[model samples]
Target: MALLREREWYAISLRPQGQHRRLRDAVTRAGGHLLALSPLRIVALDGADARSRLRDALAASRCVFTSPNAVTCAARLQALTTSRTIAVGAGTAAALRRHGIANAIAPDRMDSEGVLDLAELQAVAGQRIGLVSGEGGRGLIERSLRERGADVVRANVYRRDVAKFSPTALKRFDALPAATALFVTSAEALDAALGQLDGERRAKLLAFPTVVASERLREACVRSGFGRIVVAASAQPTDLVQAATTLV
Candidate 1:
């Protein structure tokens, strides 16, 4: 009890609804109160000829899905092909499994660098690759693959819009401590979450300790005026939970 009282037990995740369960469970098991502070919503985009475009692009030696949302969007946009596939993390790999992608593998480290480190991705001087992701992301992955002599094509399968919570919702959440640390996964979501707050509220949010998924996100937090930021080694929910447990 004394050890539990030494640190505030609240941990917040700013991801979408379908992305919450594992993190929530991890936080609860870690003796912390998990909160969902979603500031963005993912909407898959499909054009009239979306299916045809996806079919053409996915006709490759390998295909990479950047997120669970990427897999979700791709599943809706077109029929997944028989090409070898990869997911960026455990959450994403699970989503793929639910979607019947049984052979999918997520790297031990969940990030672009991890994806790039896969033995399968190396020594592909003339192979074709397709990346299914949201509008903007994985630029490094694409660039690195190109440099490695793979022909890579990309398709934006979804769009993420700002979450719309009523004033009542924000007011209710205010009852939770402003010093509640946030688990921020993306720079865009961080900006959106902070944008919803007033100057004072934003200040409070920044002053609260934050656990981010990457150094890039940490830099984004710094630019957005976040004061106390901890960069987790990976984007896994378990990593975030373990990080929260060790915090002061």
Candidate 2:
């Protein structure tokens, strides 16, 4: 995505730490300020220990990391037989790389459809594959991979819970003189942020050009009366920035 900011831009990140840093830096370096909105819901993995369960899954199958969160968790899950790793997006692939896991492959697009297009996945059609992600996500990857004859085993590594909004975010929201623009990565984040605000703050936020990462999230914004909702081509920050150009 190209940098196009006619007005001062405020970059919003709804994802976790690994996903946020690089994109936030990219936006800021390109002349936009950042507002971090993390709706992190702690994911309680089944069983007494998350790592042991993840290890069991990894040992039995290849791994598909759905987000940077998944990548971070999978990277930390004590190597279990060196399973194959696939990332849902470039940022996740980068996360795996940063953690010294070099075999991770990312698709051209970040969605489930993009993951199905990988030749490696295509070749492994009857094999068992492990999915690493949080709860409450669309099961597109799991369904699609299963349709292609892959046995998808899900490994819930961590949980997602909403984080408290930073004082900086509140200050920024209060200072906006007119209808502004907002970029978000997930519905959970959007909901969490809105949930944290008072009625006055919600009114101000509702009057903005809103951009979400997926069509599902767009619907969420529409339900909340967001002024305009544009879905990013991919969840990548660069893609979000590109979408921002059209919104502006």
Against the true structure, what is each candidate's TM-score? 0.88, 0.81
lDDT leader: 1
Question: In candidate 2, which residue pairs clash?
Answer: 39-162, 40-161, 40-162, 41-160, 41-161, 42-159, 42-160, 42-161, 43-159, 43-160
Highest TM-score among the candidates is held by which one? 1
Give candidate 1 regions above 4 Å deviation: 1-8
C-alpha positional error of residue 133 in candidate 2 after TM-score superposition, expressed in Å: 1.5
Relative to the true structure, candidate 1 has a C-alpha RMSD (angstroms) of: 2.7
Candidate 1 clashes between residue pairs 3 or more apart in a chain or in different chains: none
| Tens-place lDDT digits, model 2, residues 1-248 | 34455567665566654446776776766567766666565554555466765775676557888887776666555652445778888888887788777888888867777887888787667788888787766488888888888878777777776678778767866876543458877777778888988998888788777778777678789898786778888776777767765665
Q: In candidate 2, where is summed lDDT lowest over 10 consecutive residues?
A: 74-83
